[model samples]
Target: MPISPLRAEAPPMRVGLTPVFLDDQVSFLSRWRAWLEKKLERQVIFVQRGSYREIVELLLSGKLDFAWLCGYPYVRYRRQLKLVAVPLWRGRPLYRSYLIVPADDDQSRSLADLRGKVFAYSDPDSNSGYLYPQYLLTMQGENPSLFFARSFFTWAHRKVVEAVGVGLADGGAVDGYVWETLSETHPRLTAATRIIGRSGDLGYPPFVARADIPEAQLHLFRSALLEMATEPMGMELLESMRLDGFITGRPALYDEIARMAVRVGRL
Candidate 1:
């Protein structure tokens, strides 16, 4: 009689997240990791990349099974990635780019008014923190170099707020969602900054996987995320992350970012 073949164990799933949130939010991350591991019923490997570019590269290269990625990179590599889910912020999967300046400043009423001033950008790959603002300038025939006397990237949305609020930079671009959350938790840091301009509703970043992920695993991950709000532990995680819930997102949500890239000639 022939012996039955032995079944091989599947490898653990790898998940990558961009460093968009506060660095000290370790408790939430710990809970998130535990919840995901339990819900997925497979060993879950967690990875965090400080830069969106690195995280996206890992996801696209198939080194990461899933990633929480920025909308800008998502649109840039839409062909290579697939949407898993989008976070619901204030009941909708939309956010805005905020142009900010020192609260005491009376010279600027809008983003264009801050032309020729020093500017702080959050990150090169940030949608609300950089790309949308760059696109705004481009719409008026301006780019960062031409519109601002000098510009620098703070590399994080919270740092962008601090740079502008403390007068290190005359103005800055940042994520509105992050700004609001900071206002509530770290009032001292945001008290001296005022929003000068804001964009219309833009797509928020999303949880994504490679276009080549196995169908069964993809469904399991997506379903788990979509149902996170209903679970006790998941609810705590969502609250800590300032998310209302998760939803199945459409690729069209990122079309504006793609158009912005084209307008700025970065596509």
Candidate 2:
């Protein structure tokens, strides 16, 4: 038998993923790292940031090769960042924001009913967790600071659900997809929460890279994601996360969110 040589590793790629949608961070980090490495053929160095603003800054500074960022932040920095891909969740690159209250609380049928109660917001830069809610307040001519007796940012969608479920807050704004997935994966935890309202379809979050990445590499990265749904292993990974596949995104898809942000003074 002839001797075989070993294959060399590809150059490492620096990546950052938001913990916004992840409830089981350890498992998600492991699976995502493995999937990204295999697909991109690069050793990924996963970076951590506490908020979307920080992640955007890291990418803008050229410290991160790419990042998974919320739609709100993506639109905020679209001028400096380029969209690599957007996850198609349930067959569409769209999602919604949800306002949830305790399941047993029948009195609160709508957001207005929950006025004067404490509210939980996930992240300041979050469309589902904060922006959409603020937009709703503005549309209703309600002031968040005064409409709700108090409001706090929980930093994560799961935490927002937890806060509302545990009675720490009267209600919360959360990612509708996260809440639905959590209901299936962690039923007991979310059984106490009932969605009081939901926002219209909004652009899904995206995998973004610096606008200055080499043209060839940028195209390759986008292709890898768009083809993930056809690969058996990639398909499996997407299924586990309740994602349909990846799709190319346009800046116009996020115009509504931007409009909402401007209405709420976030833009």
Candidate 3:
């Protein structure tokens, strides 16, 4: 599908989705699209991108009407994008990041033990995958780059888990919600991974509409999402995404993420 122009007219609200790795997970995207079309009362389309940055750029440039964005990118571009809502996992407004190692590895037990070890981080714009992990490392009085012998970005939480599981890296950070979901649904992947430490809870990604979208349309969009978790089909779709509920969100809630970004010199 083309990156822009959802429809010639505005009858069927065109909603764009940015799945974490659309290129490799066509089935997942297909299922998500089908679910959205049936439940959201809109013509849903999935927009594949190389990274979170690309997705944020698309949203900021007015190429997409709405997007599901990570916390870091949302915070970075809040001035340009309006926060709509976010999926709540396990009835909480936030999730965490797990610093994981191989289940059998005995070399590391804490953040301090990881000194000089290799580390794998997810996309730079990820909250549970990157920001919180970086914050935790800094809290320990260790610079992430200096403490790790080598580091790289995986751009996906699953790849970070896989890297740690296969001993490709001594340790890495993965989204806690993703880890829990994978453990429950994909035992083979979870069986090989173990969490050694966890970062403080951080807000999950939010579904945002561009600042230029009409106020009435934005309200309608938010209303549709606010009631989604209660409807039968909406409940099923949330379950498929491993979400418990959806909550209204505002840009101010992410000020902490932006502060952290500045502290880490990422801003």
TM-score of structure candidate 3: 0.88
Q: How many clashes would you count in candidate 3?
A: 0
lDDT values, one for every candidate: 0.85, 0.84, 0.75
lDDT of 3 at 111: 64
Rank candidates by lDDT, best first: 1, 2, 3
| RMSD to truth, every model | 5.4, 4.2, 2.9
User: For model 2, what is the alpha-carbon lDDT of residue 77?
Assistant: 88
lDDT (10s digit) by residue, model 2, range 41-153: 76667777777778888899998988888889988888998888888988899999999998878899999998999999998989899999889988999987789999998
What clash pairs does model 2 have?
none
**Model 2's TM-score against the true structure:** 0.93
lDDT of 3 by residue, 31-102 (tens): 656655555555666665767888787778877778878878887777898988877889876777788988
Best by lDDT: 1
Of 2 and 3, the candidate ahead on lDDT is: 2
